[model samples]
Target chain A: MSKHTSMALRRPSRLSPDRLRVVVPILALLAMLVATGFLQPRVMSYFGFTLLLRYSLPLLFATMAQLCILVVGDIDLGIGPFVSLVNCIVASWLADQPWLCGIALVGAIFAYAAMGAFIQYRRLPSIVVTLGFSFIWLGAALLVRPTPGGTVPDWLIAATGFRTPLVPMPALLAIVVAFIAHHLIMRTAYGTVLRGIGSNAAAVERAGWSLLVGRALLYGAAGFCGVLAGLTLSGLNTTGDPWVGAQYTLLSIAGAIIGGAEFSGGIVSPIGAVFGAMIMLLSSSLLSFLNISTDWQLSLQGGLLTLVLALRTLSVWVGK
Target chain B: MKQIKFASASALALLMALGCHAAKADDASALKDTSKSGIALSNSYAGNTWRQQMLRVWQAAAQQAIDGHIIAKTKIVNADASAPQQASQIENLILEGWNSIVLDAASPTALNGSIEDACKQGITVVVFDSLATAPCAYKVAYDYVEAGRIPARFIVQQLHGKGNVLVVRGMPGTQVDVDEFQGAQEVFKENPGIKVVGTVNGQWTESVANKEVAGILPSLPKVDAVIGQGGDSVGTYQAFKAAGRPIPLITLGTRQEELALWEKLDKATPGGYATEASSSVPGVSSIAFWVAQQIVAGRKVPNVVKVSLLQISKADLATWLKVTPVGAVASPVYSKEWTIDLLKSIAANTAPPPSPGPTQNK
Candidate 1:
């Protein structure tokens, strides 16, 4: 810790870009919250925040899953369908057959790990491989629940609906998950080694870390987060749909990128990713609150995303 | 002057009695003041042509309601067909304190939790078109079975109950698709002479229907008639045209493109090319709007309200074609008065009034 502090102190300029990335998403989130509060002051209350952040829990978890893959220097195009697949399992089997649901979820993780190992071995592009897997996941989900009807387990609903007096459950869950993910991915020694693999796989391999195992573990972690996201979504919705999470693929990627995770890998902020997801979620609410025309809503959302990216770029240049 | 005054007084009494009789029949006395009520529409998607038309119809209805002081204000929020996003939007609408929320949902069951929450808060909730299955919320929906039955019966009649028919189905696994398919299948099964030789999932899109039909065209026997569940008739016609096959009696949706093609074929052919067009009208949003308004006004409403499918026959085809814009569906904007009568009929367990076709040109 002292060494890191001293190094950072010695070369503050080198770390400023990373610092700016974290700070910018936070600033954007705050700006959105403030704007929303201005438009609908009632949303400033505890209940209001609860409502605003309720559906974001799934997105936050999905973004973390994307972050796990992004940190491994591979994008998972199948995460959206994989999440939907997990949701179908949770909604269908978890209620009547807990053992079957458990087995299926574990099998999904193994499937993801196998895909990762295969990609590493064959030198195949992760994008193409995962895109292919996306169809498989979608087909499996459709087979499990052909339509959008399933009973979410009562225990799961009770867990997701768990509330507190001072803080909203969804907000609390996001913060807690962010902290744990941050500690696992940033604070530990293996975390450094994992990031090293992303930055220099050959060097890490030379240092005696099995690249296949590392990639598989990261993919497994991503699958785990996706399962959590799916389960939470099912609980919140009280139902399952094969196509419900189809939009999460791009949304998660955008959230991870806006949170300071680079496509080239070796950098990520768990806290920032959560805030980035929150910002994206809140912007839509803000637009709705401001009564923007429905025709302009989608394009305006795209414009906001571009504006944030540009701001991040500007900040990076300024930091330099 | 005395005799005239007495006569006028008796006439006023008679009119009052008639007014009471009508009010009792329609339960208009149950309506409470809703001048200060705010209503909102939480639409699941606005990407497709049908959804776009629905939104326009909703906005027109909402604006008139606001102008006439039926509602104080109205708002609309559209999500990108994501259930969670729509659920969140509903929560936001709840926060905005809308007295009533009319929604075209993304999923039937996915929005139940949020919808129930709204209902718990004493907010009147109306789910229409793509409806939610929340017990607490009212549902406005088309008789999809009837929609399917109409087209199948038309095809059966056209073919004299002896032909190989092709079925272009809508999005697989959807309730609408299932109901329509069941209705069509029931009709086809009863008539042993009509064999459904081929069936393809159209996903309710023109291009997909065309592609699927073209792919299956070579393998299937000659198709004498084609039955489609809306949005696929033009594509089916195109595929048949491309395959150099005789254009059979293809049942159409209310799309202007389909109507135009029908017109073209009618003019070109020796005998007039004839078929029927029917689908759930986009203007059902206006019906949903009034339902929400009436509910907010403390009117008793059924949990499920069945709307009539908009059907255009050969006689009404030219009239609908003339009024419907290119790329838009034929729909009649449902008025508040009509909705009230519909509720009365539903309550009375009588035949609901027929939909008045296309109020004005779009």
Candidate 2:
């Protein structure tokens, strides 16, 4: 009698499978907002949103970049320093010579594509290759601007720093980025092919798709988003720092996972990834506002991440 | 490959002959160099402007000493922020037989063993900003607590003992950050009417402070005063300006940009924004150099000597800015006699090194 009752309880509810993909992240975000609101009631206001979401643009772009790699069943460990290199390039080179900076940034995307081809042709693991490339990017950035001071271009700052009447610029940019990412990675036909390659590379190969070209395109797309992330960060700081984007590698991975992306499966939700990044930003700010020490804030962030992912896993298992 | 090898062999032989000739020349000139001392500066980090300025102070002071016939030469080994590299660099300095080793350590404890080894080898080890904890090393550091307290007291007095203040902190968990916050908090505790509205981590970088402070300015209600760590006041002031709020009284670091901004403020209005500035000063490193000179000169010195903080008022902003270049520190260099006097004063202030309590059992 107990087994029958438990089996009945475990049956999938009225919530559709499509809804399941984003529901957890959405709920986690709402819960984070409520928690933050409780700690600081002023956080419910528009001004608080501006403060809380000020740094979300770069993080959102970074998460989207990670999502591209995850969808290709390969992770780019180099995205962090790659972004830092782009930031350094923009802050100094672009600030001085906009035309030259534009060309260099475009050149970097081509380089990323070449990197993908090299990894594919050499049959190297992405983790090892990208990890090695990260050092190269870091070295290149240090060589370009050895210190943490260079002005970001005024045009880039003005563009990203624009504020809508009621909506904060960060929140507005996050929505636009999420919408574009969702359209490209979720709704397009080529997007399905990318996800399918992640799911079964052999099957995709048997279907007469050039795996090499597909991977290059995926990596190149990630490079494009990484550049955007870098630009956003430099714009926020009003300058470039070689060390700024290093922490974003792990953060992007965590955001992608918490947003309902899987490592083995080519499943991801772009809108959910943005929400995930916001949740991360809000959690730390909220913890700080609660007067928690910095040491505990880190552990608490890890704990929160683990709890959310564990809950999503439990929910998925129950539904299955 | 054969041609390359032949080329390299010829180059090597030529280089060896030239090296021998140079060695002979040095030997011939040894009489002139014999009276000068060799000092090595082993810097664990050299990435920031402050470290750069400190290096400049060391180089200038060392050059002055050389010209004055006090020291022969100076060698600076920049570890690029690596503690292990710094440890090995110190060992190299010891083996190189320098008369004195001036160290700006990366971590307080990581280099203690190397420093002790250097000390045991009859090398005078002088540790300055970001100091070493080795007991054998003589330390010259500014009073970091007072660096924080002076700013807090200035802010308190400016606000007439009651106003909302924001604290823009430096790198968290570092001793400088901890001491500064503690000292500021001590002053804040005394003044009950002064409420701390918020604290932001500026990391002692201008852009970081500017962006972080600007982000929170909307949520904060009328910040009357701002207390920030060194290397961040300009950015804090810029944040307030961007927010279209009147710049509150903020303590300036020794950065020349700050003094220039202070000058601008004075010109735009009068009296340099009516604020005060204080810093540990880049020239403090020169004082450390002077102390090393004293030690090499066989003058007994204290194990640790605390340099006092420097303050620049509104009236003196122009004078300070005139001497400091853009982006450099506005630190006053103490004369040789003044350094000796300062060291003597610090030695008298601290307790006498534990008298060997009636010979050990051995």
Which candidate ranks first by TM-score, i.e. highest? 1
Segments in model 2 whose C-alpha atoms lie over 4 Å from true places: A1-122, A125-320, B1-36, B270-272, B348-362
Native-referenced TM-scores of chain A, all candidate models: 0.94, 0.92
Clashes of each: 0, 1
lDDT of 2 by residue, B181-214 (tens): 9999999999999999999999989999999999
Could you give candidate 1's per-residue lDDT for residues B324-346 as a string of tens digits? 99989999998898998899899
Where is model 1 more than 4 Å wrong at Cα? A1-15, A123-125, A294-305, B1-30, B154-168, B188-226, B235-248, B264-274
Q: Which docking class does model 2 fall in?
A: incorrect
Candidate 1's residue-wise lDDT over A1-320, tens digit each?
A: 99997987787764487778788888888888898898899899987887888888889989999998888788889989998999999989998999999999999989988888898888788999999999999999999998888898788888888888799988888889889989999999898888877788899999999888888888889888999899999899888899988988988988888888877877888888998888778877887888876568668867877886787778778865
Candidate 1 residue pairs in backbone clash: none
- For residues A270-303, write the lDDT of model 2, one tens digit per residue: 8888888887766656655554533465478788
